[model samples]
Target: MADELLRASGLESGYGGVQVLWGADIAVAAGETVVLLGANGAGKTTLLRVLMGLMPAWRGTITLDGAAVTHETTDQRVRRGVAYMSELGVFPDMTIADNLRIGSRFAPRAARAAAIDALYARFPDLAGKRRSLAGSLSGGQRKMLGIAKALAGRPRLLVMDEPSAGLSPLYVAEVLAVLGRFRAEGLALLIAEQNVAFLDLADRVCTLERGRTVFTGTTAELHANDALERAYFGLT
Candidate 1:
């Protein structure tokens, strides 16, 4: 992929002594949306952590825009246009506006203010509660705020972990619609999600089994493979 935005080859990482990823490889192209699917404990979160520099990779090379970034720090990666939204969502004690400020802190003062205003306009629910603590929001609203904060940074590649987790159907639809708008705007996304509903937003799907990437293909190709379904979803 000539326009590849991020690529990881032979990725291996774990906590303390336990190895979680075993030679996982994945790539994301500019303006593309790649969905990572796996069962619980399949190393999905670990992979995201390694990519974001939150954890060290025991062995592998990570490249962003064709430059090696395996050794970069989390802040370094963020400065290089990579923004991550963890599965846990936002800082509960912080006000909604404060959370957005934290995410957009890398921008200039003028740009940061503009970004916050844009976020408020984009997420009216959060706008109404901009002064409220994040802890006061519902699970779904927190998810929305997390995503909004990530976008406030103006990231080129937004890596999200389970953006739809614990949301009602209505919130799920709203989240999907928001993602669709970003996709249309040519933002690259690498999302780790359990929800199959995200297939509609993905340009490609990568499946992991036991910390290793076992499949990479289009949604149509994934739907046609019963073996992959069984391996990733434990379906018959």
Candidate 2:
């Protein structure tokens, strides 16, 4: 696990007086993509929230680059090479260019401009409308912009929650292609998604059941397990 970039063990957290995670464990290696798969209410989002520091861990340890970050604030985690993109992470009122600027604010002042420009070049749809408000874009475009913003900071690990959620088939394919490009560029990613199509992009898969990690293995391993796949994916 020397190449491990992010690790969470025995994670336990939830809303006030309500526990949602029970000793869950997950990890993402350097330059790897790990997908989180589970049924609804299985704590995928909760675990992600804890990992991103948006919620306190009732009991557990989160490490980034071999350093313990269990209690670090969200901003601290971001500064330590972690970037999170929630389902609706974009700032609706902000201009596309401004949003990218905010995303790269943590990056070195000298590098921020180039990074933003690079993202604009990569996502020309946004480039053509850089001056427009993010709110004006379609749902798919908003998600794309959110992703570009997250990458602006040059994070070592990018944690995303349902990047393909609420998108049309075409948009979903576009999002997956963008993710594939990033993966090829060696950006580590941990994604929580319900789309089975993600299996094509996953290097590993982790299944959560009732807040606990019931399975973690290669994508092929998950495919080979008939019952487990049926139980979680609702494939009869």
Q: Mind sharing the TM-score for model 1? A: 0.96
> In model 2, what lDDT does residue 22 have?
94
TM-score for each prediction?
0.96, 0.98
Give the per-residue lDDT digits (tens) of candidate 1, residues 1-236.
96999999999999999999999999999999999998888999999999999999999999999999999999988988989999876899999999999999877678999989998998999999999999999988898899989988899999999898889989999889988998999999999988888989999999988899989999989978998766655588
CA lDDT of 212 in candidate 1?
99
Model 2 Cα lDDT, one tens digit per residue, 68-170 = 9998899999998889999897999999999999999899999999999999999999999999999999999999999999999999889999888899989
User: Looking at model 1, which ten-residue stretch has the lowest summed lDDT?
Assistant: 227-236
**Best by TM-score, which number?**
2
Global Cα lDDT for candidate 1: 0.92
Clashing pairs in 1: none
The reply for model 2, stretches above 4 Å from the true place, is none
Tell me the spans in candidate 1 whose CA falls farther than 4 Å from its real position.
Answer: 231-236
Model 2 has an lDDT value of: 0.92
